[model samples]
Target: MGAARVTRRGFLLGGAALLALPGTALAATAPEIADCAAWGARPNSRVVNVVVQRPVKILVHHTATPNVTDLSRGAADALARGIQNFHMDRRGWLDSGQHFTISRGGFVLEGRHRSLEALRNGRKQVEGAHCTGQNLVSIGIENEGTYMDTEPTGVLWDRLREMCAYICGQYGIAPTEIYGHRDFKDTLCPGDVLYGMLPRLRGEVGGMLGQRLEGSSVRAASWPVLREDDRGPVVEAAQRLLRGAGRTEVAVDGTFSAAMAESVRVFQAEHATEEVNGIIGGESWPLLAAPVQAGDGGEAAEAVETLAATSSTRPPSRVGPEQWQQLLTAAR
Candidate 1:
């Protein structure tokens, strides 16, 4: 099919129906997604605000459930309701954690209440609960299936690429910003099989949108020693960690500025001794990147434990190694 055109009138309406052209064919703009109500979702009990800024990345997740073969719309709708019920009733979340759900049959349904409206506007994002530290700045898309053992169906994969391309074009996001959920979290979400497909997915999205593909979101096993004046996503990640750790002065923007240097110095002073320089070296990255479990004796973990021991009152007496690990991970 040809590229779908958007009329000025349609753009002004700002309705979910304006997401596509008058036919069932996919569009260059946002895909024709079924809203939560259309999928028989119950109304959210509380109010939700769309984040004023566009999301910096798109996080992909797999439902981690059985790969259901029923490809009917009713099945897809039921899947959406079940996920919403689980997230709300069991997980105690306000609504669905993900912003969108892609069915094995290629159906795309808005997961959260306001997610479709936000996407139609193309200037804001609905905050998601999919990733802990990334909830505010990342868009979450959950594909329905377990991908650890098998790959997604061809229909599901094609629709995902098209939806991602449309989202990227609308938000001015780079194709490289697409990432598996495990990139930022500790769990193996989006699974081994689907996560392996991210590169090809990114490439196809870039090709479709005629945009250049940049770097992937996966962090190297070992990060370079970052100091003042260093700048990039790594620095941004550090900044986010600092902010989460209660260093509110540091901005999470990608640039490593003077404020960031001071924040890093404060964190170093509180978490590690010996050297209080604002540099993030082998001693700091692990503590800031992810939780350090027991038997996880790296240089960074040792430094963290040592610092925790020195604290006179904070971290509470009841806090154990696992709790400490959680505190540090959330900070990162």
Candidate 2:
């Protein structure tokens, strides 16, 4: 859905009024930010209300642009405009795809209109277009510069930490929810150099907030090798994913039972992987978690169909084409 647009004049006026109110000033504890009006963003053709659900995670992305040294407000504004133009005019999105953007010089700007306002109230989030499946559930932050080779500047990193800590505080989200863009998608965004620093980022954010880090709550981006008897939330996650992929018998009891193993074997064989062992390792995790759609053939489609059939009370033969389509859409 498209985002509703706020005129530049209205946005600035609103900002001024908000600033005049108590608790609206950009405090020392909060990162200084530039609203969409500050970046000269055009009004969106369509604006949607902020979704009231609290964000579950923070997804980080890199702009994939050159690491320009200009850290001035003008430069940051220009960069924001460029990104918005690309998303709106080129990508055909209603507004900026991300909720926020940070420049190389450490200037943070609101990406989508009303994003800053939402954060200020700590009430809701502007639905972003950054990540496909996670747009409604997570906050997307795009960092300036390509980080495939070199690391982000010290200033940029520090600002990112502050921003993350502030966001976590505002949303009541945990630091462990921080994730690289590549963690959810196939792209090399937020680049290797930056992505490798996520663990440290999470730790620093946690430290900044004076919160003790909890290992159990963190979601592992990569699946560690899991053989029979391995059990935890990760195992449960795998079971849920497999069940969604069509293993109806695999209960999400967090146990790697024989039935779960057999399901894994069948999945591996269907995918034509070299190893057909019931164990779920690196090879099986990605396939299991990857999205499936209608018209998709091979093992993945079969798995999805199997799950759909089992989820329904009706027999497999009785399930119609529209029902299957609905199942596929829901699975995604």
Q: lDDT of all the models against the reference?
A: 0.70, 0.71
Alpha-carbon lDDT of model 2: 0.71
What are the per-residue Cα lDDT tens digits for candidate 1 across 1-332? Answer: 12344533244234322333232233344556888989999888677767788887888999997898898899899999999999999988889999999999999999999887776667789988888778888889999999987999998998898788767766667778788876554345788789878888887777666554545322212223456677654566566656656677877666888777778788878885335677665445545644545556443344344434444323333434445443333333
- Report how far off residue 40 is in candidate 2 (Å): 0.8
The TM-score measured for candidate 1 stands at 0.62
Residue 198's lDDT in candidate 2: 82
Candidate 2 matches the true fold with a TM-score of: 0.61
Q: Per-residue lDDT for 274-295 in model 2, tens only?
A: 4687866545666775555556
Q: Residue 288 lDDT in model 1?
A: 65
RMSD per candidate (Å) reads 14.2, 12.7
